[model samples]
Target chain A: MLKIDELEKCYRNKEKRSIFHTTKSKEEKKALDGINIDLKEGQALACIGENGAGKSTLIKCALGILSPTSGSVRLFGEDPRRNKKYCMQKVGVVFGQKTNLWIDIPVIESYKAVKQIYKVDNDTFKRNYEMVMELLELKDIIDVPARRLSLGQRMRADIGLVLLHGPELLFMDEPTLGLDINVKYTIRKFLRQLNQQEKTSIFLTSHDLDDIDEICDDAIVISKGKQIYSGKLDELKNVYADKHIIKISGMKTGNILSLFPGVELTEKENQSIISWDKSCYSVQDVISGVFRMYAVDDIEVREPDIDEVVSRIFTEGVSI
Target chain B: MKNFWTYLKISIKSKLYYRTSFILNMISPIIVLCGQVLLWKGIFKLNNASDFADMSRNAMFSYILIAFVLNNSLNWSTENSLSKDIRNGTVVSKMIRPTTFLSQNIADMFGGVLIQGLFYTLLVIVIFFIAAKDLFVPSFSNLLLFVLSAILGMILRLMINDFFSLLCFFVTGYLGIAWLKNAITNFFSGAMIPITLFPVTLKSIAGYLPFKYMIQVPISFFLGEYTFADGIKTYTVQILWILFFIILHCLIYRKIRINLVIAGG
Candidate 1:
């Protein structure tokens, strides 16, 4: 479990003042401000944000890698800043862009080093190593040096190395970045199982919305160093996303435009797509009206996906 | 301690993985040692001097060989590596580990130099046996003393290097800092030239500084230049300097960690 309250981090920025740059000034740039999060054991939370939006800074603060400018972060009910080594014993972190495995050594060697470093007992090491190897599909790549591995292979190796100690909490910053869809899916599935079956808490940040959609139940949206929304991913889509799209394919699609007033409709050769605002018309009423109007070959209703919902929240500055 | 050994093992394994590069690195130092020896021999022949600074030609040659080996044992740019890690953001991996930063870096430094250390050490023994058998051999007790001093010297060197490497966190570039450290260490530690050959003023200055303890003091013990009492005194000073650097390292690291910034996400 982890808790962050009013956690703020400010970095000093140096600015050159004169044309010759003889004078300089120091300014404070807030990387994170008034951010709060409480991740319980076995809960997987997605931290959604734009670039430079302080997601990584928040993780560093929580991990005691960076001291917060104000407020506090507690890991397992202890101030991480004061007790970082103790807190880190039960914590695992993976930066997708950077590797934790030693680049020149085989993946298995690095895992063994991690085992010794974390003082994991032989039994625990064996159990976790087997589970991680099986779940991450790392058996083939285990003997390869990290530098020779492809990006996906290296990432899988990194994840396996981090899990070899059976950390109670995992902080992953873009764990699936720059990977093919297959590898990403594999990693997400592995993480989901880790959370659900093993009861390990996950705090993840990524630009991939699908990663969030598939792996997390709760979500926190941040933009420009501030938390904009924090709640269930389902509620985020339902509340912020007002438009429901319906596609109807039939021979008589020409007159569908005038049938529904206030609803946006796009007519094609054989298909008519209706964009219905939930505020203006109920989905049930719209579907019934469409069915009563004409014979349809096929009709499908689609709610906004998480990608659209999150993009809307960011662009429209929606907050709750 | 277990973490330290593990990191050391990993570091050595990583280095050995690049088989060609590791072999080249090991051989390159021999070329430099040979060059230095030839250059010194020319100087001695040109001057037509049987001895320089009260050391015979064979003694000085032995000094150069031993010094070269010892210097290579401590040859690693901790600052360069640390700064690169800081710049590339790989330092975050180190920060999140369950071990302290000091232990990891120390293990890594020693591990990186271990192979070279063993290689140079064997080279020195072979060269001494094949080419310089007439060179003075220390008593077994003196050899034991030399080993102790050399171990302490290695510790002292690592401590000094670690202290300087921590400064990389405060600077954007480590080249200037590393150059300064190397210049000072090379000049004062007698790695480039034995302290016995230094002028009175330079020798006194070296005595006041801790760098001499890292190289010259241990080599002095090896060559029986120091009495038993002198060896004891040298150790006392080495331990004190090590203690100083340890305290300074801890204090500076604490300050640096407050402002630690990993360059990339």
Candidate 2:
């Protein structure tokens, strides 16, 4: 439901002259360079990038919060800036660092305010509000002021506040930022369920890989404001996930290293870990080979984590 | 309208959230009013027959009290909160809404003025009523004009404040701007001293500028100092200035969208 073509954004920086400065100098910095992207209807797209990678810049330009220095963004086949009111009606946005709810009001009061502001009819409002509160587990804390809520509680409330309007598309910037594992898991599962049941298109940008695995089907990797990889998440994983982890107990690192000519082995208390390219040998073959060579113990074979794959892609480039 | 009311309710609820702080805020304005009362009464007594102007002592007191209330409303601090919204990216919340910047600001002003400023003004008014039974109660016609002028004055203040709030995007100087506005309005809107008290050139400058209409003219109309013709002329000028700032707010907002629009910055 969103399209960006050759998007380029340049920010002008004025020199921070001295305390008694005389002249004004300007420098142009490129925040986004030649970005082209399209997100189809009902697809949850993950924007993978480190900080300052222009993910926010791209989203802001699409949402019409920021005017692009060049190129165009079309949402639902119309310019977001031109049809902002109509577009915003169907769009829900959340910034992890900020809240849309009133600072000192009960969570439910904020929900009621959302219902009023969106002009939702009473029946629909009741149904949606109850559903959101139940799904987000907001009932017990609904009467508590937002200022008193924990970060996780507040993020859930913020999500529910936006979802009360039943938006067709949701944009979340770092939605799981600085959150603990339990809260992050709750949000990830909630988002996945919402996307599945409602067919809601989601645009999510986060550094967390588990969130990506749980909620998103499509992936776009951005590095230095340039599109590096834009395709299926599994394909990105398969290409970069070539190594497998093997942990063996009752084995010495010296014996394992001698068996394999050029393998990196790490040893812990009673176990040795060996990492090797899957392309070089199959897991079954390695298991049999290790069993034939080594005596008694336990062995575990694990696939490389998605985070490791992504980190490799980021550091090693898209050369695989 | 429903959205604005909801926002207004929520805003007032926010102010009322800290009950003790809310009560504490009511004291400062009353204290300031008492000081202004002492200072103005002493000046009148020191002037003896009031040789400086044709205004009377009762009229001067009424002007001061009414202008005190009006100035309090005019200089309400929506811009300070707006600057925070911009800095912290909470402005994106407003952007995601169906409303414009002006609507959001108007809702905020209603919250700040009708609660934060009105409480103190009402307390001081009660003190005034107990102290002076024979003092000014505006006539029906003056009351009608006063209400209209005050409404427009509020809109004008919001527009001016929103305009400068937009400057926060470029300058990042909210405190300086706020103090400058406070100083200028105090000097020009005549909360501390009426424009009649100013020398000839300063009075002429006040006449051309819009700050007097915000506080001084409203008081003049309330005090029955302005004739019907004079009131209508001044109201028309105030309306024109309101329209000017409304357009100016839109222009400045466009500039902000072009140059600012911070998200996760």
Quantify all predictions' global Cα lDDT against the true fold.
0.85, 0.79
Worst 10 residues of 2 chain A by lDDT: A251-260
Candidate 2, residue B9: the lDDT equals 88
Best by lDDT: 1
Tell me the tens digit of each residue's lDDT in model 1 across A133-236: 88889989999999999999999999998998899999999999999999999999999999999999999999999999889999998899998888898898
Q: List the candidate 1 regions with Cα displacement exceeding 4 Å.
A: A14-23, A248-256, A267-272, A294-300, B76-79, B199-201
Cα deviation of B126 in candidate 2 (Å)? Answer: 4.1
lDDT of 1 by residue, B1-265 (tens): 8778988898788778988977776777789899999998998899899788788787778778878877887554433576677767898898899788888888888886677889898888998788865466667888888989988998898889888877887777877788899899989999999888899999999989999988888888887888899988889999999999999987887665556667785
The DockQ of predicted model 1 stands at 0.73
